[model samples]
Structures are given as C-alpha cells and as structure tokens.
Target chain A: MPQPDVVDDESVAAVEAGLDALDTPTERRRRFTWRRAAAVVAPPVLAIVLLIAVWQALWAAAFWPEYQLPAPAAVWQVITDNVQTGVAFDVLWNSVHRAVLGFAAGVLIGTPLGLIVAKVRIVRAAIGPLLSGLQSLPSVAWVPAAVLWFGVTPSTVYFVVLMGSVPSIANGLVAGIDQIPPILPRVGTVLGASRLGSARHILLPAALPGYLAGLKQGWAFSWRSLMAAEIIAVSPQLGKGLGAFLEEGRNLSDMPTVIAAIFLILLVGIGIELLVFRPLERSVLRARGLSGAF
Target chain B: MTATLETSAMTTAVRLTGVHKSFGAGRGAVSALEGVDLSVAPGEFVCLLGASGCGKTTLLNLVAGLDRPTAGDIALSTSRPAVMFQEAALMPWLTASRNVELALRFAGVRRTQRRERAGELLELVRLGGLGDKRPHELSGGMRQRVALARALASAVQGSQDGSPALLLMDEPFSALDAITRDVLQGELLRVWRSTNTAVLFVTHDVREAVRLGQRVVLLSSRPGRVVREWQVGDLEPSAEAAAIEEINTSLREVISSHAAA
Candidate 1:
C-alpha cells in the first residue's frame, strides 16, 4: 500500500487563491479596429499627401527647369497613360516574376547551407567571416561577373540575384542559431533528446525570428541584384524588366518613366515587407513579449 | 510507479564515486568537485546543500549526464534523468500543454495521445485550465510549475525495460516569494509522496533542505567536498524548527570562518 503525506492543505488552498489574484503581466494584444487602423494609417497618408503637395508646388514654381524636374502633371500623365495602356503592368509582371524566381532559388540554396554551416564547426570556421564579407559587397558589383558567365540571359540575372541573397540568408540562420540560449538545448539533452532532435525542437523554433529576419534581407538583396543585372545586361531575351525600362527611359531622356519605375520598385519592396515580413515578425515578437519595443 | 517502488529494495537511482571536475586544464584549472561520493537510491528524496560555487550544481549536472566527470565513476540505473533548472527554460513559442507534450513527443508517445496526457500533466501541477497560455503570459511561479510539469512528463516517459525515473531540481523555487516558496514546498512533498520518483534537489537554504530532503548532504566550499550529512527524514513539524536552527548555526559558523579567512 502506498503511504501519502498529509500535505498542508490550507497552504495549498491559500496559494490556489493567490494564483487567481496574481496579476497577469503579459499585455493583451492590442485589438485591431477601424479606429486603430485609421490611427496607424493616418500619419503615413498625411506624409504622402504633403509630399505630393510639395511636388506640385515645385512644378508650379518651375524649379530646376522642366527637363530636370518635369511638372507633377507630366508625371501623373505618364502614370495614367501607362495604367491605361498596361505597359506599367507588363513591366511589373516581368520584374516581379524574375525577382520571385531568383528569391525562391536563393531561399532553397541558402536555408540548407545556413543549417549546415551553423551546426558544423569546420564549415563555419572555414567560411563564417567570408560569408559576412560577401554581404558588404554590393550586389550590383556582381553584374559584370554574371554577364561574363552567362551573357545577356535570364540565367545571368538569376546568377547575380543568387550571389546577392545566399550570403544574407546563410548569415541570418547562423545569427539565429547563435542567439539561442545554451540552457534550452542543455535542458533538451537531459530530457533524453538526441543531438539532432534537440536542435530541431529547441534551437530551431527559438531562432525563428532571426531566420525570418534573414529571409526579409535576402529578398531585398535578390531584388537589387536582379535590377543591377537587368540594367547592365539588358537584352530582349531577358524581357522588359523594370531595370531595363528605367535604363531605356534614361536612354531616351524620358524623365517621367524613370521616376515612375523608381516608385514601382519602392512600392514592391514596401508591399512585401508590410504584407509578409511584418506579420511574421509581429507574431513572433508578440509571443516572446518583445513586440512593444521591437 | 510500481516499477519504481520495486527497484527501491535493490538498485540505486544514481551513484557518484570519487567524482572530480575541473573547468580548465593545468595551471588555470579551477576545480569544482574533488573526491566526492554520493548516491540516491530508488524513490529517495536527497538534497545537496552548499553556498555558491560549492559545486552542488556541477555534481548534479554530472549525475544528469550533461557533463562528464574528470576522474570518477557515475552511474544511473535510470535511462536518463529529468532536470528542472532554476529558470523555467520553457519554449516561449509553445503553450503550457504543448511544452509538456514536447517531452511526450520525444518519448515517442502516440500523436493522438500527447494532447490528453499533456493536459493531465498540466492538471497534475494544479495548472488545469491554463494549458493554452504562453510562458510569458504566466506568473513566475506558474511558469516554474509548468516547468516542473515538463520535468515530470520526462520522468514518466521513455522508460524502456522499466528503468526507474530520477528528477534533478536546481533550486526550482528560489526565485519565488517566501509564501509561494512555502506553498510549493508543500506541493513538492505531496507530489513526491505520490509519484515515487527519486529526487536529487540542490539548494543552499538549510531550512529548505531540512523541509524537503529525507537525507541532506552538506558540502564544504573550495573545490567542494562532503563536509557533513544529516538524516532528517522523520522529523515532526515542531521538531523541524529546532533542526533548522541547528543547521543554520553550523552554516553560520562555516561562513564566519570563511569570512575571517
């Protein structure tokens, strides 16, 4: 027969009472409402509106001559005409398609390469600093090498994109793995987890925020590299990518088209960040009690 | 539970003999433990007591198989021990139930069974309704209880050919307020009595050692050796006060001499 100790039930009951009264310190997620949405969107909207007003005022004042700073009306006319003719849509589709393909390829190559490098000391020791060094080299600098290797082909554009992005993705995973607390894996080990199991269950999940950060950076790199390659290695074989379009406008001295392309690039970059990366980072940060500050 | 009780008559849960640990090699080597021997038998509640740097935790780590002893024999009849660190060490991404379920998952429990078992473990810790909450959402004491639940899950799991379970707790309630600590101490005793798992608890508090341990082993500082041992398992609550005072007086003497040195 098993003998049980007569526990201090009153004390247990007391703590039980205290448990309910213990103030929950974790902040409840701020509710999303129309008002909150407006509060968030209002400032940015005002800033953009103010920017357009200033641009119109500059055009009215005829600052920097018509050739250098085209009238706001002329820029608007270009955007409206492109929207109607669907030339802007085709340019966007072509550039975005290339960027998407290159970015996917970068993720596939970089994620595994990062995992291997982060876990294996020999690999990390050999190429850790080399990888970070690669990040500092402008992706545009790869245009010449890519053109030499693949000529004026889509393969050349992708080659530059891969060189630009792979390092960042690998670097991010390494950073994420490094930042995981040593105790978590130690705890995992004592719980009878194998080395690989510990890394999977504890290290990887803990390092998710950092990996996501890396992915976001890698996308930016991919876009930049694609544009650089497009500008340098422009060919009808590569299609009318945004970079080639911008280059063409420059060649033709059509200032409005160049400005329009610039806007499109900024919008795409901002859209990915807002639509994809921001939600990912927000959920992770909020779970870790880091959302408020970070 | 019956299996653990059956092992009580013969096998020891963990045995450490002449254990020595040094952090660095040669001239800079700082010894943590030297010529230490300790053992906890099946279903035993043993507490190792010492001040900071007394190598209590180092010894526990060695026993838990987290580190290797420099020159000693350490044995555990149990397959692998479960550890509850001072910090909760809960996965922030997981809910309380999922955190417990992770141990079950590692143990190769059926996917369909994990959720129910995890819920039962959470309820065992008196955290029944709070299973869905995140670690950050809970109070410090609640988090530690969930951590304790996780440790328990590990203990009962992965027992192949019926190896006994050993639980290593490193000052698990030291961060809590005095009242919460007291309540948890009671809860621990109650749980220990029910579960029949061997516990090797490490703490510096003499009262806590006396309160929780069937056998309290006091270690001396400076490369930590076994200084004294007490079998205080059968004391009454009234007698515990005097016993605590006696232990405190001896600890004070040891501290004074060290301070004078």
Candidate 2:
C-alpha cells in the first residue's frame, strides 16, 4: 500500500523504549578533583611562606634586639648545634614518650568514666559538673600536689598529665553520648540490642564525631600538662624534655636555644593535629555526610 | 475491591479500643487522643486522614507499641506491628541490604536464611542491585523503598496465624516528589497485594488517601476523635485520576471549614 506506513507500531514501541532507556538515571562516580585538592592545600602553604618572609624582613630590619627575638638563622643554628650533640633528639623523645603515655591513660580512664556518667542518671548528676570543673583547672596546679604525693619522679609528671587530660576526654564522651540522635537509640531498642550492645554498636558510632573532637582537645591538654610538669618538677633523675630544654635556655640566657625549643614545640603540636586528628575527623564527618566533601 | 468490602471482624489484624493519651499533667494537660477506637481487618488498607493537630501520629505510635495508651489497649493477633516513618529511618552506617537484614534478625528470622530473605525483599521493592549501597548513596525514593522493604521484612518474619501482617505507616510518602509518590503508591499496592498486609497509613494528603486506601477514617481536631469515615470503591486506572480530584476538593472543603471554626 503505502511506503512501509513509515512509523509502524513496532517502530514506535522501539523508539519509546529507547527514550525510556535514555531517561533512566544512572549512578555517577565521584572523584577527588586535583583542582579542589590544590585549592585546599595552597592557602596554608602560602601562609607559611608569608610568615617566614615577615620574620626574615623583621630580622633584616633589626626591629628587635637579637636577645629578645633571635633571627631565624640563629634559631636554626641552635637546632643544628643541639642535634649534633644529640641533646635535641633526647628532649624530643622524652616529650613524645610522656605525651603518648598520657594520651593512652586519658583514653582508658576517661572512656569508661564517660560511659558510666552518660548511662547512669545519678552518676551524671553527681560527677558531671566535677569532671567539667576539673578540666578548667590549670594542669600546673597539679604539679605541687603530685610532687607532694609522688615526689620529683616520672610518676609525678604522669600524674599531672592524667589530671589535666582525663577530664576533657571523659567530658567529650559524655557530650558525644548526649548528642546522639534519639532515632538511633530507638533503632537499637527495636533491634533487641542490649544495653552493652547498643553502646558498642549504635551509641558509640553515633557519638564518634563528638568523641574525636574531645580527643583533639584532650591531646592539647596532655601536651601542655606534660610541659608544665617537666619544667616545674625538674630533677637530675628526670630526663630533659622540651620544657626542660626551654628552662635550660632560660638559665643560660641563650635566646636562640629558647626560640628553637619553642619552635619545636609548636611544630610537633601542629604535626600531630594535622597528621593524626584531622584525618580521623575528616573521615568520620565524611562518612556521616556531615562534611562538604566526601 | 470486593475482597476488602467482604473483610469481617474475625479477620481483624489490629484493634484499638477506648484508647486515650495525654501529655503534661493536671491543669496544664493537653489531650492528644480521646476514646479512639479503630480496627483493621486482614488484607485491608486503611488511611487515618487528619489536619495538623489531629493525633494521627499518636494513634500510629500506639499501634506500633512505641508508646502505650494512657487508657484502654491496642491488641494485635500477631507480633508487634512494624512502623514506617516520614523519614526513611535507615541506619546511615549500614548498607541497604544490611538494614533490611537487621529487621529480619530482630524478628527472629533464621541466621542462615537472613541474607537470602533480605535479598528477596530488596528485589520485592525493586532495589535488587542496591543492597550494598549506603543510605546516603540512594535517592530519597530509593531510601524509602529500603525502609518499606525493611518494614515488610519485619512483618513477614514475625507474622503468625498465617494472617496478613500489620503495618503502621506515618506519612511514609510525604517527603517524596509527586512522580516518586505515584511510583511508590504503585509499589505499595503491589507489595500489599503480594504480602496481604493490613496497612494503617497516616497522611494529611487526601488524594493519597483516596488513591491507596480502601477505607479512609477522618479525624477531628485536637483531642482527636473519629469524625467521619468513607468507604472508597475500587480506584481502577480509568477512573482514578478523576476520582482523586473530586476527593481532594471535598477534603479541602473539610479542612477549610475546620480552620474557620
């Protein structure tokens, strides 16, 4: 009859099917674009460069006396000299060892204490305020009591660090538990999860972000407490830590050595935060979709 | 359609009698529900349609056993009724399949057959290949599907007496787009027919109530009580679109009159 009746029912059906297939949504892959990576990394590197430049310019202008603000080169010289003599390395090792031990102890004692306070109404009401109050008290204040109790030994330093950091770690966990969305706990109940199982599976995971935040703050406290203990409770029996190095510089009136020690302390604190805590925080936030970038 | 009309009291899956609930105490007390009586027979789909302060959610909560009635009682012939919320409520940490598996596990599904049952449920909801994906990775419609599948799994695993399962839904499709809502309504009907579950759905949308429910129970404003009930006939595709419009207009009139009062 006609020239194929051009658009037959079969042809029309085939066309519609093709359009449906085209309209169907497909999952797309998400990638970490290098441009975004560069954008994130650039600002910090530039700021560091600017800071160094400003310091060098101040030194060039001789704005402050060398005794007050030592030049970058002078501080570098002190680091090199101390390294060659192995003193800087010893001090670094001593400070790191104390900080690590303090952090471990804080986590151990604080985690359980937090769980108890969060779960039990009586315990929370009784000790919650005390825990937060203890966090505000300066770790240096513990030095005298620790010395009176343990004498001028590593144990005294350890005691001071624990008193300083444990409260913050525990409070963090308490806050974390408080912040967990109520839905999760309900889900846990529906699933027949026992109290312990709920704590382990639902409550803990839900509280992770808050807990990590607490750990970050706890580490800072640990570091600061160790330094205070090291400087104030110094003895021949106790090894030289970063704080002791700064004190020795003060005794000798070696401005460059003091600057070098301060620089090392700042560097190590930033390094730990950036390398360890930041990545942990990022992963947790991203996993929960609380962060902008996955 | 005929099947729903023929449902008898003997086939009741869930029944609530003289249920009363109130918040606060003494002089300041606000009643949320009062003397509420309702029943859903096996294989029936009932919608509790109401305005904002109508206690529809409170009623569903009682049925789900999330909260107990201040007075009276709610009884189910089988195990606890499964509930679905406006939000998908899937655990963010688990894959879609694992979320369904969790419900099955809780309902005492055998350990060896849990995965297979979960997979079957995923297929039932048309999310067969999405088992391993996290909730965040799925679309809003997809997440709700997983939620529906999870609720169904719980119902299936726990339902005794060979009766249809009981489902309590609190506006499960309120968050979806119209197209997605339509698709999910179809899916809901398919699943309901296949599983023969008795659904007590709560929604503010009148068209949705007419589209999905065999019986629509309208509730009065605060201190909610049954105000009116309508038995909607078969919403066959040819007449559904027109019927929905007419029902929506009437629902709008009812809401406006209540607002004016």
Best by DockQ: 1
lDDT per residue for candidate 2 within B5-80, as digits (tens), equals 1123355888777888998899999999998888888889999998888899988877776677788767675565
Put down candidate 1 lDDT per residue, A1-294, tens digits, no spaces.
112233567658666557645745746657779998998899999999999899989888987777778876787788889889999899989999989898999999998888888999999999888999999999899888778888888888888899999999989988998999888888788777877788789888888888989999999999888878888888888889889989998999999888887888888899989998899898888887777654
Cα shift from native, residue A234, model 1 (Å) = 0.7
- Give lDDT for model 1: 0.84
Cand. 1 TM to true fold: 0.94
Off by over 4 Å in 2: A1-42, A60-63, B1-11, B105-114, B160-164, B233-261
Q: What lDDT score is found at residue B73 in candidate 1?
A: 81
lDDT of 2 by residue, A121-162 (tens): 999999999999999999999999999999999999989999
Candidate 1 lDDT tens digits, B1-261: 011223343488887778888899989999999889888988999999988888989988887778888888877777778899999999999999999988888888897798998888888778899999998888887888899999999887744457777899999999987767777788888778888889999999988899899998988776888888888898877677777777778777666667777
- Candidate DockQ values, in order, are 0.47, 0.21
- Model 2 chain B lowest lDDT segment of ten: B1-10
TM-scores of the candidates, chain A only: 0.92, 0.86
